[model samples]
Target: MTGRSDNRPTIVITGASSGIGQATAEAFARLGARLVLAARGAEALEQVAAHCRTLGGDAIAVPTDVTDAQAVRRLADRALAFGRTIDVWVSNVGIGAVGRFQDTPIESHEQVIRANLIGHLNDAHAVMPVFLRQRFGTFINMISLGGFAATPFATSYSASKYGLRGFAEALRAEVADQPDIHVCDVYPAFIDTPGIRHGANYTGRKLSAPPPVYDARKVAAAIVDLARAPRDTTVVGSVAQFVRLGHFVAPGLSGRVMARFIRSSLDRAERVPISDGNLFAPPRDAGGIDGGLRSPKQRALVGLAAVAGLALAAVLLRSKPAYGRTGHAERGPALPPPTPRLEHSR
Candidate 1:
């Protein structure tokens, strides 16, 4: 259990320029939490900071690249400079790539690993000492469904999320005895972010329909809820829950099912020139709401994915009769055997 203080808590969110991070900052600000927002785009960061201010909270924009340890350290320092102590540090920065592993360049994979995995490490390392000294802090890691279950054409992304999940779980144990520190992991499915087009690359004959995506505001709301009631883990979305169930009931079969879907998506992806240069360009147009709100096209795609997901869920649930049966009966071997008598720390 972590101790709570009455001070206006300070929050530091990475990748705050757009998407989930941006929405999260706005949500926190509305709740009167002081915020320090970080992202690579100075212009975007400033815009988000302005919105946060309009919400009646103090905010500052720090142009940061999470992949850079020095930059992340600077972010922490900036946040500390804002308030006497930090309340929460959220490592929400990440990117994605979609294509065959062989089709994607090695450098691209490395960049993703560095940004997604190493970046989190740097942010945590920078803040852990502060938390330990203050003897009270929370680390909220924004992970993904891919962190727990491997998906097709997302090898590098899967590896990074897996590493991050392990890191968060291990850190939680290490800080168990510390009553003032907390580690929370959040996993969400595809979010309707510019990342779908900007961060992910497709190489095939035709563009594939976007995956089931959620509004950034919804994800941000979940983050705020996590902050108020810190949990060791929280999975975001019905689709994510169903997918997790599938993986648990039939690990082998689930892997095959995911592979088949991915293979088809990859085959249908439009073939395009792979850019050797960094494709982290700013959005061509920006002004209104972020990617979380469903556009007409996105709504149609979501409806389709929802139907398909429901069908898949029904098939998996039927195939495995042992699910939710015999209260204590073991489910399929989706996860490793749980160790009994494990200690729970703060």
Candidate 2:
């Protein structure tokens, strides 16, 4: 922890062109951390780097597709070249596709798995050697609540996140004794970023959950906090925490409840063409290639929904602690047996 205060620690972040990644870059830059920002979009990466520079931190933009192992390796090389010691490497690249499992194309599933799961693996493989050599470094993987539970219409995404979560947990234990090296996983719920609207394709043309989403800035702050303290895992929002708790307390029940909600939402949602002759890209590219959940209205709605869900969860958990678990208490009333719920989409 005792590194140069003036120079700060150098950090490499993937998916740095926008959303949580961009916000994280800015946050670290504000703290004087030298940055090597990587993302697929060169133009957008440059913009983020410029903003980081304006914030009084040195940054180099490396256009990278995390799905490409070679490109990810180059990112690690660039970070090492920038600073002999890379203090942190954050894998934040991810994409999502939402639709009924049968309707969702195989290509969509493959792409998301590559971006969300294999991408993180590529990043870790690229940076682990550097951390091993230095005997000191941190790996931060941007995971999602979807990793913990499945949601309807997002089967591919849920699978990817779940895989990543398992990878992170196993890796943590594998390197537990290495005090000099740290691996942390962060789980955040719907974030108010253009990525939501642009990155995900809703089969029903609507979001399963209501709004009141978290701001990227909030997540960024938490990332910075993680950099300083290095916890094994952290949930970035109340909804995220609730989901985690739900998974632990009543695994099947949570999934079933979430499935019902998702089913209802999709049932009532409007279905529209997801493409305009563009097979690869999602509609509403409204936020540009790298932008996240672009619309202000959508952002507000998501945020409100997140807040409401958290509030309701809190009330339910507090008023009926037994609802999450199935057991007979000696003194209190016996709780009903928990039923499995449909997995939530992250």
Give per-model TM-scores.
0.81, 0.80
Error of 2 at 318 (Å): 10
Model 2, C-alpha of 71: deviation from truth (Å):
1.1
For every candidate in turn, the CA RMSD to the true structure comes to 9.0, 10.4
Model 1, 175-194: lDDT tens digits are: 98886588888888767666
lDDT of each: 0.73, 0.73
- Cα lDDT for residue 166, model 2? 92
Which candidate ranks first by TM-score, i.e. highest? 1
Overall local distance difference test of candidate 2: 0.73
